[model samples]
Target: MKTAIVGAGAMGQLFGARLQLAGTDVVFLDTNQATIDVLNARGVTLQTESRTEHTPARAARASELDETFDLFIIFTKGFHTQAAVASIAHLIGAESCGLTLQNGLGNAERLQEYFGPSKTLLGVTDFPADLSAPGMVSSNSRGKVRLGALGNVPRLPNIAQLLDSADLHAAVEQDIRIPVWEKVAFNAALNTLSAVTGLTVGGIGADPHARGLVASVLEETLAVAGRLQIDVSRQRIEAALDNAFAHHTHHKTSMLMDREAGRPTEIDTIGGAVVRLGQDNGVSTPVLATLCELVRTAARPGDNR
Candidate 1:
């Protein structure tokens, strides 16, 4: 399949490199000239725990592209979702589909505005990709993707097959919201806490108070999910948290990385979204709400408050 990876960040580079290596024609779409130039020149380098591989890559701004694609995978930060998806409207054909394996909520809806409901796919992934430099990504672990269509469509399996062919460990879920919400719960707890406290996964796990705070955030988020009838599995989320705390101790969350770099974090979509849902559903999420604000405050450039 001919695919366009929107947002040439870490996750975008990781998936694009894998798909390109798997014989799929891939192009990266981004606004960063440095990233686009580096990718076009050096291609993409993906480093896993086992080995490092470099794949030839192509990248361009939306105005520079004149070809349509079979699929457009969005990996932009949540705040940029609308503009990012809208920027690629010219590259979307009648049969083209848009998939958002992005974090948090409301991404599929944004894609639906352009691709229509039947062509929008919503999903979650646990894959960890860290950008060591432009055109270079490193992942220490393997992760799976769970996705499904937003509207009644039969193309879900085909897309999953495409990802599986690239060794991305993709699976089709009948109810994609379950995994999506469960992941939101996990991130609501770990990502927000890490961003605020500047703590690593293991650092939070090692502290009794921090661990207790994590538990509170998780409980609050799960409650909100339950109130919304998402049926997210608490056991699964907790198990995932335990695994991360144990094995990915030194790993910094994307939110934490953003905070440290003075880049905007996804607090609005991840933590703030959950908090709003809780309020709408009459579920209390004081802890998550407070952390959301704390992360926002911390993310402000040159503030350091």
Candidate 2:
């Protein structure tokens, strides 16, 4: 099956390279001229803990694709989701499945609006990726991805088969909402804390103040989740938090990286989501609310610059 990877940045290129190495016809789509030029000139460069490799594939602007795709894996940044998908919606056919593995919440709902709920697949990945340069992705950590339908979509089997064929370790879940919420809650807790505190994942875990802050934010988010009947348990979120800090401690979060690079942070999607949901659910999330403001304030005109 022919598959297209939307937003061929770090995580996208990592998946594209792996799938191509497993002998899949993977095409990469990105708007960055440098990224496209680099990939077109050489290939996708993947660097893991063990080794590095370059996978060859067709590179094009999303608008340049003339034929319909069987599947489209979207890995765009959270803020760019709508515009990114809009650029390539014409390439999606009736038989195509669109999987969004983006960070934060509301992404599946956004895709549903564009591609119809029946054609959407929700996915999440723990892979730590960074675009060290154009066409070069620093895949410093090996991670797993979970993918499934959100509302009884008809294309999961076909999507799963294609992913499995590409050795992507894909699975069809009975309920994906729980996992999605769980991931969002965890990101709400740690992502902003790392961004504001300027700490590594390990640093957040080790520092008593940071750990306390994470627990407070997560506890408040769980309260909101409970109000929504989402079952985001403190025990589960805490365990996942610990696992994330332990496993990815050396790595910097995307938020932290963004702050370092003087780019807009995803606080509006992650922690800001909790604050918005809490207000809507009538659940108070003081910690998360405060962090949201702090991160936004710090991301001002010349702070990170």
Candidate 3:
């Protein structure tokens, strides 16, 4: 398949490189000139716990490409979803599928505006990727992707097959919302708390007070999910949390990374989205709401204080 990996960030490079190495034609679509140039020049370098691999890459801005794509795997931040999808409108043919494995909610809706519901795919991934440099990504081989179509589409399994061929460990889910909400709950707790307190996964788990905050956020988010009838699994989410806290102790969440770099975090889509849903469903989420505001204030640009 001719694939376009949008965003060219850490996760983007990780997936693109793997697919390219698996013999799929992969091109990276990104707005950053430095990232585009580096990808085109040095390709992508992926480092994992076992080994490191390199794959030659092609990258360009949307305006620079004229070929239609078979699939578009979106990895852009939540705030940039609309603009990013709109920029690639010319490349989305009738048969093309747009998949958003990005964190947070509402990304699939933005894609649906361009690709339509039938051609849009929504999913979640726990794959942790860190961009050490423009074309260098570090990650562990310990994550899987769960995705499904927004509307009935027979070819959805083929998309999953394509990812599996690249060893992405993907599966087409019957109800994608469940996993998506569960992931949102997990991120709303860990990501927000870590961003606000500069705590690593283990640090939060180690501190009783921080751990209490995490539990409160998780509970509030799960309540919001329950009101929506999403049936997100609390036991599964708690087990995932326990695993992360014990094993991935030194790991810094994407939100914390963005905060430390003074870049905008995905608080709006992750934490803020849950709070909005809670309010709509008459479920109070005071803890998540407060953390959302705190993350926003902490990540504001040019804050010298």
Estimate candidate 3's RMSD in Å: 1.9
Preferred candidate (lDDT higher): 1 or 2: 1
- Best candidate per lDDT, number? 3
What value of lDDT does candidate 2 attain over all alpha carbons? 0.82
**Which candidate number would show the highest TM-score if scored against the true structure?**
3
TM-score of 2: 0.92
The sequence of per-residue lDDT tens digits that candidate 1 reaches over residues 1-305 is 89999999999999999999999999999999999999999999899999999998999999898889999999999989999987898889999999998999889999999988888998988888888899889985478888898687668899999999898999999889999998888988999999999999999989999999999999998888888778888899999899988988998888998888888788889989999888888999999999988887767666333
Could you list the CA RMSD of all candidates, in the order they appear?
1.9, 2.4, 1.9
On residues 34-71, what C-alpha lDDT tens digit does candidate 2 reach at each position?
A: 78888888897777778888877688998877898877
lDDT of each: 0.90, 0.82, 0.91
lDDT of 2 at 51: 83
User: Can you tell me which runs of candidate 2 are displaced by over 4 Å?
Assistant: 49-52, 138-142, 302-305
User: What TM-score, over all chains together, does every model reach?
Assistant: 0.95, 0.92, 0.96
